[model samples]
Target: MAESGAPTQRESMADRIYQALKEDIFEFRLIPGDKFSESDIAQRLSASRTPVREALYRLEREGYVDVLFRSGWQIRQLDFKQIEELYDLRITLERAAMHKICRLDKPPPALRLLNDIWNPDAPSERAFGSTVRALDESFHCELVAAADNDEMTQVHQRITDRLRIVRRLDFTRPDRIDATYREHAEILQALIANNPGEAAEKMTAHIRTSQEAVKGISLERIREVSQQHRRREPGRP
Candidate 1:
């Protein structure tokens, strides 16, 4: 029992480290191109080197970081061209899903759930900040799932995961937040009405708008956010 429990505890520690590191990346506390050693991370997080290494390998696989040959791990830089290509792929897959969704004999139950969240009757009932960003991700994912293609859904989810860091930056402004609510409501209405053409157009435009917003993000922008974040939490390095 002791031996069995030990591995679980180690795994839990790795998971915690993974979450912490991911938060640092997302909040720009660890800016792109930043490099640090496993020992440094373990010391900063007060964790064991073994778990820190495990967590970093996982982040590397997820495209968040890369291992250097003789040096330490470095945060992955944002590739604008690759990001643009990914956005195009996402649009293609989602547009196809929209057509399939419209052709379904029965409406997907998830549509109702999406409608409730996105098409709320009053502004007072809406979610805010990071919550809205998460919901926005789920909204597109649910639409893909509604098309009833497990393979496509899986691919879409992978793209969504890869895009999350840059994509979430779109929600930082009040105007973007308002646009998201309005655009999501429009897309939801189109989907609910079983109008594939309209839904596809709205989804394409919505994603394009978000893509455009993230394009304005520069290294300086990340540095500014990191400075603000470090100021708020003085302990972060």
Candidate 2:
């Protein structure tokens, strides 16, 4: 019989494979419409087929890949219309959150933390690369959570997760990174003044700007970014 921790080991392997595959998709190493098999990933990652299957299914649930009967798996194509609709829905949720937040007796303490990050005193203190992308996501998610609505926060998080890969592309350019910091600061400032209308407007503009930026991503852009990624980490597959 297997040891008690065997399942844990399998789970760990599955998680590791999941992250690796997700990163590949994020970095455009695995472009949309690319197809491969469980054995392909299992061999490439030096993992077992069980863990590879586990990872692929998780990716499928997240809309990153699709399974094929008696074939294997394929990276899902970008659905621009669906992406646009999601951005629209995200704006709606966040706008509602701002209204709720403004009605609070006292502002949430998370605002202070967000201010520290987005309204940094020095540009030299600013984050770069994937760190900034993660911070950008947290900024929006935190705003929704601050509304004190559990259901809203949960739904917003799912949207954030679904949109993350495309959203990260926005931060790849220096201008977009600068704009994010500036725009996030504007939203925070409006919230501090307890102006829900202004806060919601700024949030909408910020998200729409990000939406437009990422929507411009094309296969050429993906290849360009993928090349840069490979150059940065030659050892990475």
Candidate 3:
């Protein structure tokens, strides 16, 4: 039911809050398990509580945050199990994309776009990581487009969106960023050579190695955060 004077579909406010929160979370400005208050966000953004609440609801639905019983909202923590699932899903979709890329006689524009962003001469780790992340996303998207599977692409995109925060965290580590670029080069070479099997293998290995490297972070830290958020009441000291 439309409100007496409200528009049927409001576009911008929810999106503004979404983008703002997403950037903060991805850049680690909002640490995992950090508590958030709807009132605080609403005040800071100079928006009504309704839109801020809407944004928080959407974030929670997307697995980026969890709504505690009495507490406000908490950023979701990363876990090995979720990381493993992300890699497994990527392997499946990426292999399909590799096959499609190899079958084509000429490279698609998407592949070219990926190559441009992944240039090896990038100066800073932050810039390099940003490029790599973009390229990584473009590669998978190109694969889906090449396969001409809209439904699967949507599904993959949804999963990727859920993993964005963790992926950003993984890439921010200096050593991981370097290793990621090296792996990207190898993967690109395999794609250029039209070796679907080799490309898939390299992609899978890259994801696995990255996951293994970050496995050392204490899951206890994540658990502690989750517990704290769960216990804290909204507006409490």
Could you tally the backbone clashes for each prediction?
0, 0, 0
User: What is the TM-score (0 to 1) of candidate 1?
Assistant: 0.84
Q: In candidate 2, what are the lDDT values of residues 104-220, reduced to their tens digit?
A: 989999888899988846788899898998888888898899999999998898788778767867777888888888998999999999999999999999988888888887767
Displacement of the residue 66 alpha carbon in candidate 2, Å: 0.9
Residue-level lDDT tens digits of model 3 in 1-237 = 133465656558978898788766654556676897888788878898898888888988877889888778898877668767876887788778778778887876666666665656664533556765665666566667765677877877877776654554456567777777777777777887788899889888887776676566564644544346546633222
Candidate 1 weakest lDDT stretch, 10 residues: 1-10
Best by TM-score: 1
Give per-model TM-scores. Answer: 0.84, 0.83, 0.70
Best of the two (2, 3) by TM-score: 2
* Model 1 residue 230 CA deviation in Å: 1.1
Q: Output the lDDT of residue 193, model 1.
A: 88
lDDT of each: 0.87, 0.86, 0.71
The best candidate by lDDT is 1
Candidate 3: C-alpha RMSD to true structure equals 7.3
Q: Candidate 1 overall Cα lDDT vs. reference?
A: 0.87
Misplaced by over 4 Å in model 2 are: 1-11, 120-124, 128-131, 172-175, 235-237
**Ranked by lDDT, top first:** 1, 2, 3
